[model samples]
Target: MLTDSHTHLYLKNFENDIDIVIQEAKKEGINRFILPNIDETTINKLIDLHKRYKNITYPLIGLHPCSVNKNYPKQIEKLFQKVKNTQFIGIGEIGIDLHWDKTLIEEQKSAFRTQIQWAKKLEIPIVIHCRKAFNEIYTILKEENVKDVGGIFHCFSGTIKEAEKIIDLGFLLGIGGVITFKNSNLSNIIKDIPIEKIVLETDAPYLAPHPMRGHRNEPKYLSIIAKQIASIKSIDIHKIAEITSKNIDNLFFKKNQNII
Candidate 1:
């Protein structure tokens, strides 16, 4: 009964054995997975995954920030059409990423703002992909005034100050395999943060946790992250699962279930 708040289950990385990978993860109690679209190229695959596992696979539609190049406006327009026609779990895996290329900084900002605005208009939550552009992302968030929409800051590796700002903005920090890294320092930063503002994610086929480090990640590794977080907070693993499960559900489903 855990959620991998952010993952790319449609990517070719998991193409060879997606079924086996998913089945194994279900055995680990990682049931639901939120799959975010990379761009137009991935929409069909994402839809197929959701169709195959409707209950367990939640699909979100959006043009990823990295995919926000010169042709992004047209891409967004197409995605908007999809949004109008159907319901999406969220609007995301969208934001600025300076890690790869900085030339498209302004383009990324524009794309992020447009998607955020769309989220506000649709009353859907967002899944942000921020990498080395916290200030830029924060500035746009502030400018857009995202008061009603909530989201998960996927693969959050920001500072305590940034964490405070994110929490203040009504967003949850998406805890992933990075938390289990030897020097991630995320363990210390998130320990004091309220558990209610945290959610579990693997960002799988990518950032796997320790012991599984340097290996191709999968949704099954979410249990490792959950166990590590529990040990970090010195709380029972069930409590971690309980709180995070609710946190993720609230982020996407908007239900205010009591976390007890």
Candidate 2:
């Protein structure tokens, strides 16, 4: 079985035919999905999806870096209270994103740090969302010493050096549709990284793989990504599924099996 280590199927993009999407994904052997919250506005929907697909969906709670602002402290406080009585799979899709705006860099850093501390306190892993702010995010993670809980660098497309650094810190690289894209550096990067340090994800309704690149992404398309990884790594597709699914079990389910 394949696990989509990160995806946003709770978003409105899938509202019209979510059941079809889930069914199709299962047909493709993509059985597990890790859903991360974008912000307060998405928490209810995220949790609702988990409830609806309790057997296959895993939920995470956090504030995305792009959603960070002056009022983040208040937002984080409210989110903490919402999940206080319950257990979540992890804390994240949280980190720094400087691609769109640089105005809230400090705010993003503060929010990321706070969530990391909470993840440590909660004894859960974190799912990181990093885009164009690796240095900023890396510094904070180093200071926080996130090796304690371990996590995944969601949608990782970094260099060999960066990948090595992340692996050294005890984190898995969250590989996704990007690896199948023509001209993408990710394929070359993955060749050097060990399969044990990687996990598959679709990041759907986004980053759909080749041949379906322009279309809306679905968890079912994860098989296309698996095929591409198999080609790149010179292994069978089933082997990709076996190794990556084991990686996910080790990272998310094995430790939190009782609570999750």
Best lDDT among the predictions, by candidate number: 2
Candidate 2 has its poorest 10 consecutive residues by lDDT at 251-260
Off by over 4 Å in 2: none
Q: In model 1, what lDDT does residue 107 have?
A: 86
Looking at model 1, which ten-residue stretch has the lowest summed lDDT? 251-260
Error of 2 at 20 (Å): 0.5
Per-residue lDDT value at 180 in model 1: 89
* Candidate 1, superposed: residue stretches over 4 Å from native: 255-260
Per-residue lDDT of candidate 1, residues 26-49 (tens digit)? 999988898988898888898888
| Residues 63-169 of candidate 2: C-alpha lDDT, one tens digit per residue | 99989989999999999886765568899889999999999999999999999999998888999999998898889889999998899999999899999999999
| Residue pairs of candidate 1 with colliding backbone atoms | none
The CA lDDT at 105 in model 2 is 91
Task: Please state the error at residue 78 of candidate 2 in Å.
Answer: 0.9
